[model samples]
Target: GESVGLHLPTLSVQEGDNSIINCAYSNSASDYFIWYKQESGKGPQFIIDIRSNMDKRQGQRVTVLLNKTVKHLSLQIAATQPGDSAVYFCAEKGDAGNMLTFGGGTRLMVKP
Candidate 1:
């Protein structure tokens, strides 16, 4: 069996500091990746995304980096806020793209 998941189950950061969440995927054929932020009692929200063809992509306050060589992915959040505290998930899709395989998720706790 293969696994596609977060490397850490939790991450704690100061409100003004930056945060980095990591993920690993077993399927090398996966060509698309997405990072999602889920706050308490809400659905997952799209944070950022990266393609296998590109190593990195950025959004408002988020960045997604992918390393196909190691099947690794990371999400970087700038100036983490209490509002940013949530469970973050990394997902991958093969050529089909929309059919996603998700990571276990890393809970980001921003301590003010």
Candidate 2:
């Protein structure tokens, strides 16, 4: 099969520091937004999510911020750890379908 997409870009930061990962979504009609983390050789794991109507959502040691006006989204990780190192992607889905469109991932590198 053909390649589904490109590899994730990388973000390097020190462990115990805060990290911010940013993404820009394509579809304005997209109402649901989710953040996922994919470790090496593993599938994407759900992190956090936000609705189009809302601006922000938070999870354990992670926070998702949405800016619908700019079609921008960001994920913040507090006290970053080595285990938190992974490729992170932002996905969105609309009310019309169950399918999700994923943005290119940003790989997080937590250096201890």
Candidate 3:
């Protein structure tokens, strides 16, 4: 079975600093990848996405890098802020369905 897991459950960083979140996927057949950000109790919001054909994708202050060789994915966030403190999840669209297979989830803690 394919599953996504985070390297860390929580990450603490100072405002204005950069953050990097890592994730691993179990399925190599996954073609589409997506990174999402979730607030305290809200649903996940789309951040950035990348396809298996590409290695990297960038969005506003955010970047998603995928490594098919190791079945790994990473998210980079620049200029961390208080408002950026939230949970991040990595999702992949495998053979299951159009829905995404989510990671274990990582909590981003921003220090003022």
Highest TM-score: which candidate?
Answer: 2
Candidate 2, poorest ten consecutive residues by summed lDDT: 1-10
Clashing pairs in 3: none
TM-score of 3: 0.89
Candidate 2 lDDT, 1-112, residue by residue in tens: 1123876578999999999999888777899999999999999999898999899888899999999888899999999999999998888887697899888788899999
Indicate the residue-level lDDT of 97 in model 2: 72
lDDT of 1 by residue, 11-112 (tens): 999999999999888688998888888989999998888889999888898888888899999999999889999998888898654689888888899998
Backbone clash count for every predicted candidate, in the order shown: 0, 0, 0
RMSD of 3: 2.7
lDDT per prediction? 0.86, 0.88, 0.89
TM-score of each: 0.89, 0.92, 0.89
Model 3, 1-112: lDDT tens digits are 2244526479999999999999998789999998889998898998899999999988889999999999999999999999999998898899777877888888999999
Give residue 69's error in model 1 in angstroms. Answer: 0.5
**What TM-score would candidate 2 get against the native?**
0.92
